[model samples]
Structures are given as C-alpha cells and as structure tokens.
Target: MKIAVTSKAFAKNETLKSELQSFFPDCRFNTSGRLLNESELIEFLGDCDGAIVAMEQIQAPVLDDVNLLKVIAKFGVGLNNIDLSYCQKNGIPVKWTAGINRQSVAEMALGFMLMLIRNLYTTSNQLKKGEWNKSGGQSLYGKTIGIIGMGHIGQELTHLLKPFACRVLANDVVDINEFCEKNGVVSVGKETIYAEADIISLHTPLNTSTVQFIDATAFHKMTKKPIFINTARGELVNLQDLHDALLNGQLYGAAIDVYDVEPPTHKELISMPNLVCTPHIGGNSAEATLAMGRSAISHLVDSLLGAANER
Candidate 1:
C-alpha cells in the first residue's frame, strides 16, 4: 500500500521511518522541512492508500482530490484541523489517540507557571542584555492555581501540582465534580477562577464556543492579576487583549507555547518584558515526538494491514 506521512518532523525521524518501512515500504515522507500548502499536500498524497498526518487541514476538497486515500491516522491530539463530519460521511476512518503527549504538555505548563511566578524568564533575558536585576519572584507553593480545562493534559498537570500543595480551582463544560472531589480540586465556574486564582492556565480545545474565550472581559475579571499561561490552542485567546493586559498591568505575566499564527509576527506582543514565549514545542519533546509518531504508524498499520491480514 502507498502511504503518505505529512508531518515534516515525523518524516525526518529515521527511527520512525525504519519502523514504518518495515510494515509498508511504499511510503512517502514530506522532507520539505515546512508545512505543505494545499497543492503541495495534494501532490504529496496523490494515490496513497493511507496517511499519517499532523496539523495539515484535510477537508472535503482535499479528500475529494485524493480519492485513493483510505484511512488517516493523526500524529497529534487536536482534531480542529480535520473535517470529521466529512470523513464520517465518506466512510473514511480517522484514528486518533488523545493525551498521547499529555505529560510533555503538562510539564511545559507547570514550567511556564514556575518561570512566570519566579521571574526566571525576564531576569534571564535582562542578564543577557548586560542589566543586573535581582528580583526573585514568588514561589509556586500554596498558590491558588486555576485550570480552565480538566481534560487529559489538565488532569496530568493537576497531578503534577500535588507536590506544590497548590489550591487548584478547575472549570470545565462537562461534569467533573467527581474527579475534582477525588483530586481535592474545587470545581467552580470560570468567572470564579478568573477572580480568585493566583495563576491561570488554559487547556481547553478550540471550538466555536471556546474561540477567543479569553478576551478583554476575561482579563478584566482577573482581580488577582495572576500569571496567565496558554499551552493549548492559540485561537482560544485574543492576542491583542493578552498584549494589552500585560502592557497595562492587568496581568502579572504571561507565557505562550502556541499562537494564533505559528511564527507569530506580532513584535510588540512577543517583545513584552512580562511575557515569555516558545515556538509551540510543548508536545514536541523527544520522548513525546517518538511516542506520537509510533502511535500514528501503529494506527495506520492496524487499520490498513492488520485488518487485511485478519480478513
């Protein structure tokens, strides 16, 4: 079977490449070192029987053009990029495993909280610029931490925070009262979390309701002026509001792992002294990358090859 791997990072991994080849030698990998556009993606996926993809949008148009494509296995957790309704309508199988890199992202969120609270990021940058400032920020111990989503990554982060003895206030659309009770978390409304917490972290998925969820209004409700962190989807927060919040002292600090635009060009926002940013590497840890790649490959193998063998 002809297979296409659209994730540039996963394509370049020799370990994953060899493992995939053992199952299906007729595989194509995107070695362009960048994300492919629609035309490029169509050409790359042409006539392939199965595919393992990451971040690339696979809507109805792409699916229509790539008629030979049978099954798709996702390399990461987010499904906002894929048109699930279209895939289901066409009887195409999309295999995806959530929380495959839960620990990696959870760790990064915790790191962001520590960095912002302790003023590690700002101090490090100041030192690099030949400025001496000895402002050691506050500790994470016994602080009120507000977690906006109680999904896989959020749950993992809750577990990680146990050692710090933090007061965790959680908010979710679904019923998580049982989990909150068991974990000593206070399941409260988002507004209560916004008003009371010392630190706020977002882990919700991007959907219609959650798009631009954190705006000026949300920031205004943050009475404690807590440090804010977003390791989840970028579209969930308004970048302009975030920038304004930091500039106007509405927030203590902010840390961003993802952005509305990858390689974000908002110089003013990125250059803020009270903010720390990464190139969306929360789930790209060495261990997480390998695990995510293997899971995708396994899903494709099981769907395409293992099923045929069973038949």
Candidate 2:
C-alpha cells in the first residue's frame, strides 16, 4: 500500500522512512514538504493508503476528500491539531505516539528553570565581554514550583525537581492524587498555584477552556514576580500579557519554547532581555525525535497487524 509522511521536519530526518521501509518493504512513501491544505492534501494523498502526520490539521473537510486514506498516525501525542471526533465518525483510524519524549521535555524545562533563576544567559554574555561582576540570583533549592498538568511530562519534571528539594505543587484536571501523594507534590487549586508559585510551568493540553489560562489578570495577581516557563502549548499564556508584565516589572523572567504563533512573524516579546525564547525545541533533541519516529512506526505496524487489541 502507498503511504505519505507529511511533515516539515520529516524531510530532514530520513531515518523514519528507512525504518518504515525495513518493516513494510512494499509500502511506498511520498514525502511532502509539509502538511498540506484541504485541496493540497487531497491531491497529495492521491493513492496513499496510510499517512504519518506531524502538526497538520486533519479536519473533516480533508478526511472526506481522501477516499483511500486509512490510518493517520501522528508523530506526537497532541491530537488537537487533528479532528478526532470527525475521524472517528468517518472510520479513518488515527493513532499518536504517546509519552516518547517525556524525559527529554522535562529535562529541557529543568534546564530553563535553572537558566532563568540564575540569569545564566546574561551572566555568560557579561563575563565574555570582560566583566566579572557577581550577579546575585535565585536558587531552585527551596522554591515552590507549580506544575500545571500532571501527565507524563509533568511527572518526569517532578522527578527531576525532587532532587533539588524544591517544593512541588502539582495540579491536574484528572485525578492524579496517587502520583501527588507518592511524589510529595501538593495538589492544589488553580488560584493557589497562580498566586503562590515561585516558578510556574505549564504542561496542559491546548483546549478551548484552558487556552489563555494565564492572562493579564493572572500575571497581575502573581505576588512573587515569578519566572514563567512554558514548554507546552504557547497560546496557554497570553503573549501580550507576558510582554506587558516584563516591561512593567510584574514578571521576573520568562523562558518560552513554544509561541502563540509558530515562527512568530512579529513577536514583541523577543525584544525583551528578560524573555528567553527557543523555536519550540523542548522535545526536538535527536534522541527524542528518533523515539517518536520509532514508536509511531511500531504502533502503525501493530495496528495494521491486528495486534492493537489492548489499545
């Protein structure tokens, strides 16, 4: 059967193609530059029986057009990019690689927390410029870290933070009381987290209700002038509010990997020295990429072989 691996990043990492080919030698893969629009996607999938999608939206419109489309195996766990209910209704099975990069993402968040607390970026720059001035900074030892969303990533992050002996405040929409009790993470309300956290990290999924959860009011209410770390969905925090807070000294600093808009055409926050930005590479390490690719391919293989009985 014909297959299409439609991803902007997949074009660079040719290993996935090799791995898939090894398992299903007869399957043909057509590489597209990126996720295609409705009309473009229809044309691109021409005779493809299955597809590997990354960040593209597979709405009902595109799914309706693909007469031959079967499985839509996503590289990562976020299904918000695709329309799940529509896919289910149409019987076009969709599967996503789950928790493959949990440790990698958690590590990146921990690194960001340390960097932001110590002003490492600024200090490194100053020292390189022949200034040996000692810059006082905050320590992670006793800080209260509020982890919003206690999923795989959040749990891994909690493990990392535990070594530092920092107070962990973990909150989840679902019942993660077992994890909280075992890890000594205090499960609390959203208001308490927003108000008391020394450093706040967001790990929640991007959905209607939680979108822009951290807005101007939330930022204004933070009494600690907390350093914000966001490695998850960017839109969860208001970009305008963040920019305004940094300018007005309401926030200490911010380490952001994701953005409200990807490849932000005009991010005003980039101009602020206190704002450390990365182009959404929290889980883009080589190890993590290979893990996601191999895991997704394995899931597809199992599903096709009628071995995904438990799933």
Candidate 3:
C-alpha cells in the first residue's frame, strides 16, 4: 500500500509521516505542499491506499481524480473542509480523530472567555499607548455559562469552568441527561441557553443545519449582554449579526479563534475591535498537534492497510 500525505500551508507533517511508516512498512510515502488543482492531488494520490489530511478540500472533484484512494484519515474531528456527504455516498470513509485534543480546545475556550470578560486585549493596547485606566472585570464565579454542544470538548470545558463555580447550561441534540448530571451541568434547549447565559461558548461542529446557527435572530434573542466566545466552526455565528450586536449594545465583547474562511481571505468581521481574533490556532498546541496526528494515522492503518476498506 502506498501512503501519500497532503501537507497544510504552515503545519508540520513529520509526525504523520513517521506514524504512517510504523503501520505500513512497505507503503510508499510522499509529502506535498502545492496541490493547486484537483488533477495535481490526483497525481500525488495515484496508487495510495489511505492519506493523512489536514484542512484540504477532498470534494468529489478531487476524490474523482484519485483511483485507489480508500480512507481519508482527517487529522481533526471537523469535516467542514471536506465534502463528507459526497465521500460517504461514494463509500470513501472519512475517518476522524476524536477525543484527542479535547483538553487543548477546552483550555483555549476558557482563556478566550476570561480575556473577553476582562478586556485583556484592549487593556494591553491602552497601556501601550500610555493610558492609565483602572477597569473592572466581571466575575465568572457565580455567572451563567451556556455551552452549545456537550460533546467531549464541551464536557472538558465544564471541568475547567468548575473552578470558577459557574452555573453551566448545555444544549445539544442528543440526550445528555446522564452526561450533564455527572458533570454538574444542566442541559437546556438552544433558545433558552441563548437568552439566559451571561457568557456563551460554542463547542459544536460545522454542518448544514448548524451553519449560521447563531445569526441575527439568535443574537437578538440574547436578552443579556453576553461575553460571546466561539472556538468551534466560524460559520456558526453570522458576522454581521455579531457586528450589529456589538454596535447596538447587544453584546459586551467577543473572542473568536475560528473563522468561516481559512487564512481569512475576506476582510469584514476580523477587523472589528471588540472581537479578539487568533490565527485559528485552537488545536495547534504542541501536545494536541502530536496527539491528533498520531490518532489520525492510527485510524488510517486500522481501516486502510489490508485492502483499502472504505470505512
């Protein structure tokens, strides 16, 4: 079996290369960075059984080009970057690495929440300009926090928030009754969570229904001015709604780590002062990167080594 790795723009693929070698010794591995066209990716993935991928588009267009492609062991849980339904329909399994970087993502969420509430970014800029203003920060100890998705990352975030003694409200599609009970968090509907939470953090994935899940109407529904935070998919929150919320006093502030676009080719939402933006580095921590890489590669070997099993 030949294993080909399509590299990310600024990501390190060393661990993925080593892990693939460990599983299939006879497999040929080639690392590439410039796959501008679908034909180019097809040429690289020529006879490969499975490929470890990150943030690359594996649509039917690129998928059509590859002949022996079987498994796409994506390095993370989010499948928004790929055409997952098309892959599923064509029997090309898109295996994901889950529960590997939960702690990293949870910690980043906590940091952003605290930063937004305290206005840390603004304070730093003010000090740099030689201004002395003693601003007060709100307490998270007794405030309410709404977590959008109560998955592994959401549960992990609750663990970190517990030290702050926050009342946690969780919203998810499935029955999280037992999960919420064990974690000292209460499960509620999405509308109720949006209306009552002092701080709202998103832990959901990007899907058709969830895209723009928190739009203008959702922002308008938030009764209390919230310290909004989104560490999940960026498309979940409509940028204009958020901008209006900030402009019209509907929101206190926001901390964003992800965007609808990667590397941000667009310029509308990111330039806002109230929103603290990072370079989508939520899962780029040293430990998290290695864990995701190792876990994804392991899944690839399990499903794709023998005969390029689709699932």
Top model number, lDDT: 1
Q: Which stretches of candidate 1 lie over 4 Å from their true place?
A: none
Q: How should the candidates be ordered by TM-score, best one leading?
A: 1, 2, 3
Give the per-residue lDDT of model 2 (tens digit) for 1-311: 66677766654677877888776665544355444677877777657777777777678788778888778888766788888998888888888766778888999999989988987976776789998858858888989999999999999999999879999988899999999999899999878887899999889999998899889999988888998889988889888888999999998888888887777644678778788888888887888888877777876777664543565
Evaluate all candidate structures by whole-model CA lDDT and list the values in order: 0.93, 0.82, 0.79
lDDT (0-100) at residue 294 of candidate 1? 95
Give per-residue CA lDDT, model 3, range 1-311, as digits (tens). 77776746223456556666787764543334443456776776778878777666777878877878888887766777788788888888888867777898899999988877877777776789998757857766788999999888999999999889999999998899998888789899988887899999998988878989888898888899898898888888887787778878888888888777666653656777777888877887888888887777777767865454653
Candidate 1 lDDT over 128-175, as tens digits, reads 999998999999999999999999999999999999999999999999
Q: Give Cα distance to truth, residue 156, candidate 3, Å.
A: 0.8
Candidate 2 local distance difference test against the native: 0.82
TM-score of model 1 (CA atoms)? 0.98
Clash-forming residue pairs, model 3:
none
TM-scores for every predicted model: 0.98, 0.92, 0.89
Sequence-dependent TM-score of model 2? 0.92
**The 10-residue segment with the lowest total lDDT in model 2:** 26-35
| Cand. 1 Cα-lDDT | 0.93
Question: Which of the two candidates, 1 or 2, achieves a greater TM-score against the reference?
Answer: 1
Between candidates 2 and 3, the one scoring higher on lDDT is 2
- For candidate 1, the per-residue lDDT at 194 reads 96
